[model samples]
Target: MREIREFEERLQVENTSGEIPGFLHLYTGQEAIAVGVCEHLSDIDYIGSTHRGHGHCIAKGCDLNGMMAEIYGKETGLCRGKGGSMHIADLERGMLGANAIVGGASPLAVGAALSARTLGTGGVSVAFTGDGGSNQGLVFEAMNMAVVLQLPVIFVFENNGYGEATGHDYAVGSRDIAGRAAGFGLPAVKVDGTDFFAVHEAMGTAVERARSGQGPSVIEAVAMRWRGHFEGDAMLYRAEGEVAELRANKDPLTLFLQRVEGQVLQEDIEAIDRQVAAAIDEAVERARAANPPSAEQVLTDVYVSY
Candidate 1:
């Protein structure tokens, strides 16, 4: 969780300084959702990510240097400097990729789940979508298809109060994501996304069910995003003190530390924080030193000649 948080904090700084290019969607407050759910997953498991995907990628074990370099458009990036912030993919690590299009991850997870089921891999696929994506027709279709096929997919709707700038209250017709999923004939639950233990417990149940061939499930992680839809967004759509209240009351890191205070040493937590910060600092330096993709390398991955 510290890794994801510190990574994006560094990104916000670097992006502001014009070191990183392209539109960036920082996963500032949604760190626990990814980390908690991914804790139950293994290298053989698969996950589909969102445009705001750095946290998911990190939680799923993508190399920090490759991801930072990818965001910086460096030749050594995960996508060789082409896919940028919204499209980093490390297939070898079972991250299908992060998609820019809303609802894109739903069917991607569906496909992966289908393959897993067909090949008897005992792996599960997860789709991480935002509240806005929960409203997409493709997402519903993907969910329905997953139910119909009994595939091992988990639909995690990280409802962070808005679909971009629009409040979810104004957009989501049902106003209840888990209830809607339950209506679709799958076991669905809503958990406090800020509470890592809650999310981890819910995901553990869902993962167990999936691996046991009990089919797909839905997990609605009710949380906050702490930043704009994208880095430059002013977020005028929110009421005054909205983000401030979330930061003060619902901070995932703080909540997690509080929960683990007696069981884990504060000094150990501080050490992890320092380690994550230094690691991100090194990633930034490596990205800065790395060259952009050469012109000769540009068209290589863009096409399939065969």
Candidate 2:
């Protein structure tokens, strides 16, 4: 949890300083979901991330230096300064990139799982979408398709209560997101997204089901966002002190710290903090020194052999 907090703080600094161009979607309060899910995954497994994907990327073993550089839009970035904040990807790490469109990655993850099954690769695909995206038609289609194909995949719905500025209660007609998945003949479960052990346990069950050819399972992780939808949102819709209260009382990092305090020493947490800080600082220096992509390079990768 200290590691998660360290990354969140680094991301906050970058967002506030305008180091990460375009939009900055924060995952400040949803760390446990990513950490717990990724803990059960291997390097060969694929994960499709959402707009708020820094936590997922970090948990999947993506290099912090490259992630920071990518967000800064530097040539040394994972996407060579072309993808910027919304589309940072590292295929070698099995991160299918962060999707900008709502529910866009759902079908993509299903397709990846289908390919894995077809090729007998024994690899599973995981899609991490938000509460807002759960309403999209694509999510339903992907769910049905995964059941039909019996693909090894896990659908993780991080219900953070708000989709952009709109509340989930207003946007989604259903009271339970995971309940909707049962209609597609898939097993589903819900977990408190702030509890790492709960998420980890739920994901273990879901993954085991998928690997055994039982098809996909939906995991609804109910969580909250500590920050607004984006960096500059005035958040007029949210009530006063909502975010503050969540940060102070229900923050996943804080909860994890409290839970592990007796087992893990304070010095260990401090060491992680220092290491993350140094890593972020070095990434900023490297990104600043890196060159942007050339004008001609944009048109060069459009075709395979044209």
Candidate 3:
């Protein structure tokens, strides 16, 4: 969680200073959802992520330097600096790539799940989508397809209060992503995304069910984002002090440390914090020193013609 928080916080600074280019979304407040769930997955499993995907990439074990360089548009990045912040992918890591389009990756996850079941690979696929994305027709279709096919997929809806600037309360017609999932024949559960244990337990149940061939499930993690949807967003739609209140009372990292004070030593936590910070600093420096993709490399990764 600390690693993800630090990474996104650094991205916020870098994006503001023009070191990072293009549309960048931070996974600031919702660290636990990614870490908690991904703690169970392995390279045999797969995950499809959303536009706000930095956390998923980190939790799924993508290299930090590559991620930083990818965001910086450097040639050494995970996608050779082509995919940038929204589309970091590593097939060997089972990260199916982050989608720039909302709800886009859900179908891709379904495809992965289909492949897994067909190949008898025992791999479960996860689709991480936002509250706003839950409204898309593609997401619904993906859910229905998973249920019908009995695919080993988990629809992880990271319901981060708002989708962009619009509150989930206002935008989601069902007003309950989990309820909607249940309607699609998925055993759905809503967990407190801020609570790492809760998300982990819920995800464990869903993962077990999928791996055991009980079919697909849904986990709607109600985590709230600290920043605006994108870096430059004014966030004018929010009430004054709303974000501040969330940061103070609902910070997942602080909550995690508080909850695990006895099990994890304070000095150990501090040591980890320092290490994460230093590593992030090094990643940023390396990205700064790296070269951007030359003109010839632009078309290389875009398509695969038969």
Query: For this target, which candidate reaches the highest TM-score against the unseen true structure?
Result: 1
Cα lDDT tens digits, model 1, 188-222, are 99999999999999999999999999999999999
- Candidate 3 lDDT over 153-264, as tens digits, reads 9999999989887899999887999998899988999999999999999999999999999999999999888888888899998899988999999999889888988898
Ranking by lDDT: 1, 3, 2
Greater-lDDT candidate between 1 and 2: 1
Tens-digit lDDT track of model 2 for 106-168: 999999999888888788899999999999999999999999988899999999989999998
lDDT of 1 at 178: 89
Candidate order, TM-score descending: 1, 3, 2
| Clashing residue pair totals per candidate (backbone < 3 A) | 0, 0, 0
Off by over 4 Å in 3: 304-306
Model 2 local distance difference test score = 0.85
| Residue 147 lDDT (model 1) | 97
> What residue runs in model 2 are displaced by over 4 Å at the alpha carbon?
1-4, 303-306
